[model samples]
Target chain A: MRKQLPPEMLARDSRFVRTSIMDQILDPRNRKISERTIGPAKLAPGRPASADRARNLMHGIFTGEIQALEGAGRTAFDFDETEAPFALKLDMARQCWDEARHVEISIKLGEWMGTEIGEFTEATFLYEAACAPDPVLRLCGVNRALEGLAIDVFNTMKEFGDVSGDPVLEFCEDWMLADEVTHVKMGSDWLRRLTADDPERRERALDFQRTVDKLFSLGGFRGETEENPIHLARKMREMAGFSTTEIDEIAELSELARAEGQAAVEAAGSA
Target chain B: MSDPFKPRPAFAPWDRRELPGLFDVEESARRVGAYKWIETRLFEALGGWIATVPELDVKMILGRHCYHHAWHAELFDKRLPELREMNTDRLCAPANDAMEEFVEALREPDAPELTIEKLVGVFRVLIPRKIAAYTFHLNGTSRVTDAPTERSLEFILQDEWNDWREGEMLLQSLIDTPEELERAIRRQHELEAIVVRAGGITGLGTIGATTEVEGAGV
Candidate 1:
């Protein structure tokens, strides 16, 4: 038996063609369509049935968890026992357990919402964050950024469950949401712990987090505005120990990304 | 020669109240500790298979299994304080060297035949043992003192059975040669012998033999 390195994964899947973040950002079809034109209520319903949307989101949740499990799993394995302490690896291992449960829960939730696995296309943006070579950066990218996105998505779905008066969705989302908060905090704690003596290394990791946070904003998929589908979970982020200024900066980055997306779309139209 | 369905003497009494006593604190800690290791190892094994396995369907199954183990670990960890076992730190450590050795094997860089080896070890040996252990403990423990643990075990045992069946299907489908199957079975037994010798789940030996509860009803 010989040791094999972790295999490289392409973001595209054969069953599902990925709609790149850039493509999703500058979607020409959505160009020239204003929030006012569609009206807030009408924007909620698209050609895809609510069932389809739910299914798509559930699939995304399902895939996200798998990547999360992989990320945590890799953290547990890829590092030497000395590079990252045994306890940190154990923490990652423990998180793998949480994430594994989340994956199953999401699968059940998908079934509950009438969605099947692979019913919708998956984008691998989440997994990309986990691929960072440096564990500190990976922690910042995955635990903080990716899991932070999970908090927002889960909270939004939880609200959707509450508004729709579906106890199951509300209950499941709430349970998973609590776990996401812990995940983000774990990342935060690790980032500090791993780089406590070396402030420069800590700054580099924090910078990586900012970059991911901006990318995740993805031209306003998330923001404070009503036009955004998933709102920034300020209170929840605070509970996870994110400062108010940090939350505000994320909101600003989202707005900036949205503007940049609009410019790119307009430029393409002119071309 | 005894029929499992045959009614037992009423005097033997299906005592639900004395179930908790069947597993003392040390016994409870040992089981929980092993569960934590199992969950952790399963997580790593799934990752190995997912990374190396060419078949997408197999990867998907491993993905789901990965999370199920995670949930089982959490459930076991959570059960600690309830059993009046405050030092959950004990739960994190391996109960014996066999568990430690098994995890070390899992953590080593993937072998070319790693995916098959993992499937064989988990489905053929580890999961079956887990099912047996849970079923044994389920029967021995009192429902009155620990309904939650019983329910948890029931849920986990059901998953373990499903996973084992699914794994068997994959193994049968993927391994073409009888030689491969023979090697897989042998590989699992070798590892199984270590864990059993190093004080298997409850120091009771493998459940497949010692606590072979007929019609246990997962």
Candidate 2:
């Protein structure tokens, strides 16, 4: 391929019309749901604040997985054969297997939650991170950042499964969560090896990861605090070889993004 | 967590030693080893196809197939050591140079204009050959002593057939004209001849059912 596969053209027949992330953040409809919904701890399993909200989140997750599969698949295809070594491409190839399973699992989970594919509009932000030209950057963005976010989301959903007493949900999410951990580690290991001698390139990759981490945080979708929908899995991140410093940095970025998002909403309201 | 919901076995157990209908130990080892190589290569090749396939229906099927091949690889991977008592590294190589060439051809980074052509390559050509190869081994191997191997092949066989049927359906839908269908078939066969030369439609180096162990030289 001349370049990695381009971002997919999402189906126009999708049930829901996608809103820009900014519009999603500021939309009164979403704000109404967020305002009334209880925190993750207090929310019952099958009842995720509201059935509508639960369906929305589940559909987002379903689309995210489709993109996640594409992201990993592109990593395997988009790069020049020589640009990333065969071994690294092999790793990406293996990750595709895991991601595909996750897609199937996520689809089932969506059904269990009473959400259908295309029920919620997709945001391409996850795939945007996968578009990085450099292999190191792609690894950092897709594997580290996006898969890292998956860890948080899947863990949160797993917890919801546990509290909701939904055995299947808890069981399935746990399985998927395990794969995400390995994927993140794969990204980290490659990042280190690919840029072992070149500190500057490594720095650029790390910087790219920071930008993605910020985008993923998306005004408090993730954080260590109760306010966030998904909590950073410290133990899992450590298991995936993330240093404490990195986790702390992500937490800080989460807070910054949340504040910026809140400010944008306030400005839009005043206007 | 509660104990797993284990289902009771449905069939009677066979004797561990001298079971009827089992392949010779050497033959079992060779088949398991070949499947290991096939599955591993298939997993990677499917990955490449999943990335490039434009048709959503085809992409989704390839996505599932990728994971299915991975699971198949693991099954044979576990079975290989049991059959031969050898580490996977020693026995994990491709069935033959032809098999390796076919897999390598699948992985070329060169992007094609129409994913339909690639789809034809895999569904019409590659997977059918795999099904034939697996069917050959399944029919040839004894069902008694090599029960596990037989069962694994059976499971994989069903999936291979499903993939073949799905590909056939898609090909019928996409290649509208008789002339186009004929041309595509011709083109696919031409590409597959390379793989056929390496071995044949079965991906087996040998011509037919034989007692001689395949891939022994490799």
Candidate 3:
């Protein structure tokens, strides 16, 4: 019966305190951090501060899993069966459990890497994406875009685990990475099925997807190059039902976001 | 909500529908509607808790129990068209205002720290009544005339029973101390009064099978 529940109303224990993404963006340290890094921030094992960088990313993953669980639950509970198909809601419910497990896994992983639950601040963008009024839009934004970002992040972490010789991290990331791929595939299937007869609606959903993808790109944090910490998982994405063209489109979007972020950093430096 | 589901037969409104079954179409629709509404409320509430409950085991159980409710609601929804009423939404509603009030109280223990309260409300208060109602329906309805409804009940009861046991074990495990047991007991008594007053999901007469309210309201 609770419909259109806002992200602010999301229940969290005191330990799960959140920080606004806007605050992180506006922090003066971003300018210095961006300036200090000559190129895309490399997340390789040999890179400077790689361990701390991995911890931060791991903490982010932990928070992201919690938000993903919330997103899936909201999508399952918010819309009427008329708006969201029973099958889609079923999928959303399934995704809820998967994301919950991912949260537990990420929590343990965070501990293994010397991180606390909220050592790094949390963002509600994933939950915000789930708040879309339209079910298709919700699917596109949360399941495809946000969960798609999870695929990239998890893939990067898995690779980090493999290269860094951390079997626990690598195994856990690989396990969760498979779930993310399935979640994306579920979204992709629902997106096409729901919008089959309505091209305009499909376009709207895809547009919503693009907007969320850009939000998640987080400047150059996720991209195809080594400068980015999380590279787009094209092969994994293709397996998840995203076409090469869709992947290309996301890469293009990330490039634009990174360019704009660099410009903002430069402007901050001059000021 | 759309026609993405398999096509159902377009049953025309029956003329002078037979009364061989325990529940006539109007009464059947009312019961079915109430059941659908309750199942959906359960599903939505459980779905919400899957993310909020701090305990991982509770979250895991809720994640699965929530889907069973969703399926139960869908089964009721699918059964609606078989009756005289084509519009299932009108039929699908709370049995009475007190039932509505019960739902209001049922969903209040939503905070992360209120896992005990949440489990008490659901497993201790609501689900037991649900199983009893479904069992009553199974016993009262004519197997030949109301077979599909019975079929749905059979499927739903399996889940209801399993979820209740699982939830009960969880409730027991969480209650390590006397104060925890007291918390669970107090919460149960508080909601139990409301559910008892509301006459449970099917009301005082299970499936309205009694003579006092033939073709009465849901």
C-alpha RMSD for every candidate: 9.1, 8.4, 8.3
By TM-score, how accurate is candidate 3?
Answer: 0.79
What are the models' TM-scores?
Answer: 0.66, 0.68, 0.79
Docking class of 1: incorrect
DockQ, cand. 1: 0.14
| Model 3: CAPRI class | acceptable
By descending TM-score, how would the candidates be arranged?
3, 2, 1
Predicted candidate 2, C-alpha RMSD: 8.4
Tens-digit lDDT string for candidate 1 (B106-208): 4443543555676777787777777878887787766766677888899999889999999999888878888887778777777776666545554434342
Ranking by lDDT: 3, 2, 1
Error of 1 at A23 (Å): 4.6
Residue B106 of model 3, lDDT score: 90
Residue B39, candidate 3: alpha-carbon lDDT: 86
Top model number, TM-score: 3
Compared with the true structure, what per-residue lDDT tens digits does model 3 show for residues A1-271? Answer: 3566788877666676788987766777888887574554767777888999999989888877777787788788778778887678778877877887887898889899999877877788778888889999999998899889988988888888999999999999999989999999899899989999999999999999999899777768789998887899998898888888989999999998888887777776678
Q: Candidate 3 chain A — worst ten consecutive residues by lDDT sum?
A: A34-43
Query: Candidate 2 residues A1-271, lDDT tens each?
Result: 3455555543223353555776677686544444564555323454445556556666777778777777776666566545776468667767776777777887888888887767767778887788788989999998898899888888887887888688988899899989999999999999999999999999999999999999888767788876786888888888888999999999999899988877766666666
Best-fitting candidate, measured by DockQ?
3
The predicted structure with the larger TM-score, 1 or 3, is: 3
Answer with 1 or 3, whichever has the higher DockQ.
Answer: 3
At residue A171, what lDDT does model 2 achieve? 96
- Candidate 3 lDDT, B42-84, residue by residue in tens: 8778887766676756775787677778889889988999977
